[model samples]
Target chain A: MYLEIKDLTVLYDRAMVLNGVSLTVGKGEFVSLVGPNGAGKTTLLRAIAGLVKWEKDTLKGTRAGRITLEGSVKFDGEEVTNLPAHEIVRRGLILCPERGRPFREMTVLDNLRAGAFGCKDKKVVKENLERVYHLFPRLKERENQISGTLSGGERFMLTIGRAMMSQPKLFMIDEPSVGLAPKVKEDLFARVKEIYEQGSTILMTEQDVSFAFDLAGRNYVISKGHLVGEGTAEDLLADESLRKTYLGL
Target chain B: MVEAILINGLVLGGMYAILAVGFALVFGVAKILNMAHTAFYMVGAFLILIMTIMLGFPSLPSIVLAIAIMGITGSVIYKLFLDRVKEHPVAVMIISVGVAILFQEVLLIGFGGHFRGIDPFVRGFVEIAGIRATYQQVIAIATSLVALVAIRLLLSKTRVGNAIRAVAEDREIANVMGIDVSRMCVITMGISAVLATVAGAVVAPIFMVHPLMWMHPLTIVLAAVVLGGLGSIKGSILGAFILGFAETAVVFLVPMGAFLRGAVGLSVMVVVLLLRPEGLFGVVFEEERL
Candidate 1:
């Protein structure tokens, strides 16, 4: 019950992207939601982080009217389903969205500094920034480089490092390893583990079944906007039907 | 004669730069061309005209109040109207044009068709570069230069200012980083209005103020923004000076100078835009598309 979702449903116009989905992650738990494409994993994460709610509120009454979202998201026993994205981040829930999507115009250091913008204490902001640099020394080396100029591996580091600056209690990362080389993916996933050990709970979604199974203590299989299966990596792997059918493992 | 022309061109161009900076800033961050922006300029000029001429108030405090009133109006326009239709750029543009006409008609009803003007904010003359200019011209140059510098410092030094730039680059990304994109948009609109109102109030002493005053600045600034590359501050300032000199050079060097002012200024923009579609100082890769 540390981070809980219940009866969450999201509809874009007439198509349902998430259907009455519910899940939970205890404090310090490392969970992975693994599935193939079109499985509503990103939508579920976006819904929990308050971005989908914002889109619903913003787009309502427009010509492209009405995105219906019905859900309850509870973080640390507090309902955050209706909060704005900024407010949600303030409450220690950060969503490092898919793709690096770094502020392309800003330098690497500035982009990292922006991550800690919500913090009031200058000392804390500086400390968090230094921690991010320590975790990824490559970022320190390219601190002055414009983000748009960084290589794919570097952009991924900056994206994860930028999320770290927020000092989140629970980090939700979507497809952090996508498009990365196998070698770079190994390095990046190792850093993700280091981040978990540093005492931040994590909920990650991935298409790499072997990687997810190796990293997560618990796993959920989502396909076609429904939570089709859930269990420990061993338990799910033992079920041949769940492995071959929904997860493609 | 050449020195006089250059100084006057710089002075007038400085005003245009100040006026267009707001237009560029609003468009840069919010992507709303805000046709109503010049409406704030007109409103500020009239505010100064009324306080100084009819109420016999001191000009400095009147100018300050005029800027303050326009600042609030700018915020209201963004929040109440612009924010509502932001998803549709065409709708936002139309609403802004509507806002402009609404303010123009209000001024017409209140001030009548007769022109009004304000006394100089300061009285004196100084010689610079072998050219004698009034204190008003000096004030215009100094104010615009100082405002531009302050804008630079604000963008570089303050967190809110940096947040504004981040939002301008990509609002959704900025939002995910915990910056309030909506708040930044409204605040940017407010700052843009302040610049426009200050430009209008400061220039009222030199020129006649009327309901129709908004049209010329709107045209010149649109040319400036388009010439300098849209949504770029440096480009807008550079474009303003170039257009200012182009217009003035027409009057200075040509016999039928007065008749050719608008044509000459616009021609420079057209040719440059054809040659360099992105304007002189437009960022090479960044299109301000987002």
Candidate 2:
């Protein structure tokens, strides 16, 4: 397994957000986690990417909500459940958070440059930036424009492009196609497909079933914080009861 | 007489702006009201005094050493004190006020609560608009201007500066993007301390240094920053100039304006806030701004 999770659980001050979820993504595999709202899908991805751990450390004694994370996350044969977010990014596991959260007041170019912060090789950074520009021409078009001013589709494109600059081995993206126009979503998915085809492992959580089925080779049906079903897209679609009960298909 | 006043007003405004810029920056990037900044300024002046008078150091080196000391003190304070109460504004304010008083008390104990002055970096001045401003005033104005321009360039052109701005916009998002946000906070605190110290070093000859002097100047600079809208360097400069010009006009134009110094500053702040609630160039404080 390229990425492995064993008994991962998260609790936010007595409210259980995740419950001992175990899953795996093989090297160079495209896996989609599909679930409805309140399914703990975002929390799982965040936990895997070390955000939950960061929150647990930062909000320990504050009036802010407490987060309790328990899990063993092994990425590339190394224990990574307790690493900080930036250290995880340094290790080539990147998370593109939901809803296109860029540094809003910054210019698009600056945001993209910030993504390459961990990379020291200037030549590699330049090449990655050029590739990001090529992947999302819209981001290149609005390179100098402030991120807050970008449209919905443009903002998503910028964020995804920003993540690409980090050169991730396992790209965990949460709801990339949400709130985008159908045509723009199609364009974005094509870019994602291009990335997958180029050999980086991808784990994405999406609400859109058909979109996930079309792109992901294997799928996990998670609902209310537990992995209810796991199989290939064809197997899940073939089972009528499983589709109706869990996937809402 | 008007020319002389105007010249003095601009210089005074420039010095005020320099003093407040770091305060604005710390708030802008960190969202912590560093009320202890004025204490750092006073300490800087005293450092210069001890160096030049007691240790027999040159005037320029004393100022430089003071700035360096304050810069280190800033990072240490952030790590030790401000870091604990960063998320709570009221708590931060209280702690900062406590720190300021502590600094004042320590300085008083050591120096015996007497006002003292440092030798001016320069001794003479050239004619400006046919007004005979002393080198002390000219040096204050020139140092502030040079520092401002250099800082502006540093922020706009450097990678580290860009990282600082990104963190200022949204600290969490900046961290997620692989920028070290805690390191940026330390750097910002250090820079703000240096600014306060440098301002003290340059302006100390004219204003003199006393343990309690920090309280009044802090109040004035806070007013200037608030009027300039918090967290904006340009706003700080504009607001300081506006305050300086208003104070100058009062002293020369009104019959008993010298006595109305405190009232004049208060009214100037009130007028600016009444005219534009966001200050001259500052953004509105949105809930999501943090």
Best by DockQ: 1
Q: What is the C-alpha DockQ of each candidate?
A: 0.66, 0.62
Residue-level lDDT tens digits of model 2 in B59-100: 887788889999999989988988766877898899999999
Candidate 2's C-alpha lDDT? 0.85
Q: Between which residue pairs do clashes occur in model 1?
A: none
TM-score of 2: 0.94
**Candidate 1 structure lDDT:** 0.86
Itemize residue pairs with steric clashes in candidate 2.
none
iRMS of every model, one decimal?
A: 1.4, 1.5
- For model 1, the stretches where C-alpha displacement exceeds 4 angstroms are A61-66, B264-276, B283-290
DockQ score for model 1: 0.66
lDDT for each of the candidates? 0.86, 0.85
Interface RMSD score of candidate 2: 1.5
